[model samples]
Target: MTAVADLFNLKGQTALITGGSSGLGLQIAEALGTQGARVVISARKADVLESAQAHLAGLDVDASWIAADNAREDHVERLANDAMERLGKIDILVNNAGATWGAATADHPLSAWDKVMNLNVRAIFLLTQQIGRLSMIPNRYGRVINVASIAGLKGNGPTSQPTIAYNTSKGAVVNFTRALAGEWGKYGITVNALAPGFFPSKMTRGMIEKVGIEKLAERAPLQRIGDDDDLKGAALLFASDAGKHITGQILAVDGGVTAV
Candidate 1:
């Protein structure tokens, strides 16, 4: 006899979002926080994390943040432990931290390739493992939201900005979501991913400038790029009880671009 709205209510839940200082991470934090979940955000820079915490407060969202680079193992371990200490238990996790590099395959530096793969793939596995083992697995209840990209779903030709490493890393993330979802379901945890299209963020600034926002928008049937709020609904669904029966799914929030 649960009320319809009660399914989406997160009054007692808590979430930890990596790379949450800005962009889509910030947006997802807002979505979950506004719905009544305590939120903790993490990123590499202290100043930016402070700013994001302040912004969340302005929205009346109970939010906190930690400054940590997910690319490093030490930082990942500390982030997981500290977040659990701060929130008691994490009912939801958003693996939103990521990195990208743009270079032709031939000229792509090995160091840069390592950087992208480390953050986009390795960091995700580590954090998810830490959080899952410590919190989610013990509770037998959890939600994991991975932030993937449309680039992972398809390949880009030479005409577009060359980002082979970034693309490859994201593709790994897509499959990682599927593989983990299959394994974790037995533990009463649901793992899902969000594959977003072009949005106005620091990560996409270069691509947007090179191709023009209008041009990118035209690629989608919606004829518009994603807005700040585009991911809120889908994010909420996967985080709440509304998505209890769903897992191993990658929902694309790309304004119909992938549909075409």
Candidate 2:
């Protein structure tokens, strides 16, 4: 009696996505919102959050936003509280807010390293804990989708760009997803991660400029870079009942870059 297309229906669910103002975060937000989830996006900038909210409106997606820095403990707490207040309940949580600093390992600044870790890893842990405790656990159901990167799966060659801290933090996310899934399974929460390769975003603009888009595309077996729609299906799967039985998994949304 369940239609195949109905498996992905999220008409009554709600999602909270951090760093959702732009880049991969915004893309994921669009996917969930269009699929029928009431979405609440958060980031550090009010201006950008407003823009993203407007963009979602244009697409006829039900959406709202909060501007808060996830790197701060107080801000994280407030964000989780405010999102639940606005959305009524959070059925899905997307930890997509992240930062990166490009520098050789030995020359990387301790301050920058801390900054990246605080945002990319620690923020995720804190938000997940709070949201899980307050909403998902009590409800006995939830979906957590972490936006890791392909950089976490492998080390950059000696000649590659130096982003030691960024890579390290993302690697932590991969394990974090697995560990959290193991612990949260009892609560009916499914935790998984998406490790994306070369996507055109503010974060990767510099790298794409340095390496050239054609060269980067060549690195993938598909011989092309990822586009807007590439991550939608995978995101929908993890956030929907379709992935109820799937957890603790890491899916690489690269054009087969990690395979080779």
Candidate 3:
């Protein structure tokens, strides 16, 4: 195959995206599926996952849905087991399930912090470890993509949105990607992260409805918010052969938000 053709092709591969029922995860699934990878989407809600399956069906992609709570300990391994059982072997895994609760830095509840941290940081770590040991590490090939945010890069003031725990968890994810990448590089497992800015999705619905998506888009240097296609090439590079040698890195899909 030509360099560029094979560089981006995901043909004959299998990808499993967590929290894939909607938003960024769904977008990434579409990109990988369109490129010929059989995709499996997992989420806590069966209804949502079913809907996502239908959404991808029209794309003519080999897609399926599994109901799994990534926050739960057993669900992580189960997801990998189910994927391997049905799809053969996993090549791409996106740790995209996360929880965010907003409160002032001074008054945030510890319970809320625990909830966010468990799913955002702890779950990510545990799931990745299990999958790595059971599949990726064994095969000596895998791609792990964690979804972080601009908050992870820097603080978001209260006037804008105060979710101290959210930022802290994502920061952990950023560092986790780097550390895990270093540990797994020799094993042919590349760990990377996508730090996205404002985008319209269930996660950002509140902000968009109140502030207007245009206003948030304009905050960045590009004078725009992130969109579906923004993550395509960035994610594809990391998952495809194009990024075989790239690891321990975080790619920002924030329309220059982090640069400012």
Candidate 4:
């Protein structure tokens, strides 16, 4: 019984969450912290990270924040080194940092493509690689959840926002989850991606309003957009040891949008 309880509980584990200083990433950090995991939250803005650190502190979970540019190679190393120095071992990692922009393929800049891919796709791979090489793989136990989008699932409005690169990057994220999961499963590390539908964050509100939220609800079998609470259970399932037998899966929290 105690062992089972321990499996569900995050006590004694340390988690590193990228883009964790705000939005959904911050929400996840708060959830895990209250559940008893020591968390390390990172993002580009030191001020926002500090604010998020205050929020996590109120949850009574041990936590710290690091300002890191996920798009930079140097930042990745510095971020990893700082995390290890502070948290010592990261039992879990959440790759929630991402970049997105809305422009058609024809109009998209090569620089834009490179930027989105670097932050969303390449950075995820680099961070996971660094963390795995330094800590998780050697310990032979780890959990990683990458945040993707349903935009990766299907195209949004016809002209709301083309974001060709954003779409492609997220698609890469979905597949990356599967490929990494397969390779790392034998080592007791699980890699997965969470594809969120229409949630109002710094991203997606423009598209949602332009597409007409009610129309979207009607199209989505679930009849609604995503809410904050809708995120917790699915995430907890993957992060907890309850997910021990699971890997290489993409759990869509998209309000049934992907179904139809």
- How does candidate 4 score on lDDT? 0.87
lDDT of 2 by residue, 79-176 (tens): 99999899888999999999999998889999999999999999999999999988999999999999999999999977788899999999999999
Q: Give per-residue CA lDDT, model 4, range 1-260, as digits (tens).
A: 44766677888889999999977898788777877889999999999988889877887878899999999999999999999999999988999999898777788899988999999999999999999998999999999999988877777677456778988899999999999999998889999888988777777677676777787677668799877677777777788988888899998998887886
lDDT of each: 0.95, 0.95, 0.89, 0.87
**lDDT, candidate 3, 169-216, per-residue tens:** 999999999999999999999999999888778988988888997788
Which digits, one per residue and each the tens of the lDDT, describe model 1 over residues 1-260? 88879999999999999989999999999999999999999999999999999999999999999999999999999999999999999999999999999888899999999999999999999999999999999999999999999999999865788899988998999999999999999999999999999899999898888889999988889999999999999999999999999999999999898887
**What's model 1's overall lDDT?**
0.95
What's the C-alpha lDDT at position 53 in model 4? 93
Task: Tell me the TM-score of model 1.
Answer: 0.98
Clashing pairs in 3: none
Candidate order by decreasing TM-score: 2, 1, 3, 4
> After superposition, which runs of candidate 2 have C-alpha atoms over 4 Å from their true positions?
none
In angstroms, what RMSD does candidate 4 have relative to the true structure? 1.8
| Arranged by lDDT, best first | 1, 2, 3, 4
**Which pairs of residues clash in candidate 2, taking residues 3 or more apart in a chain or in different chains?**
none
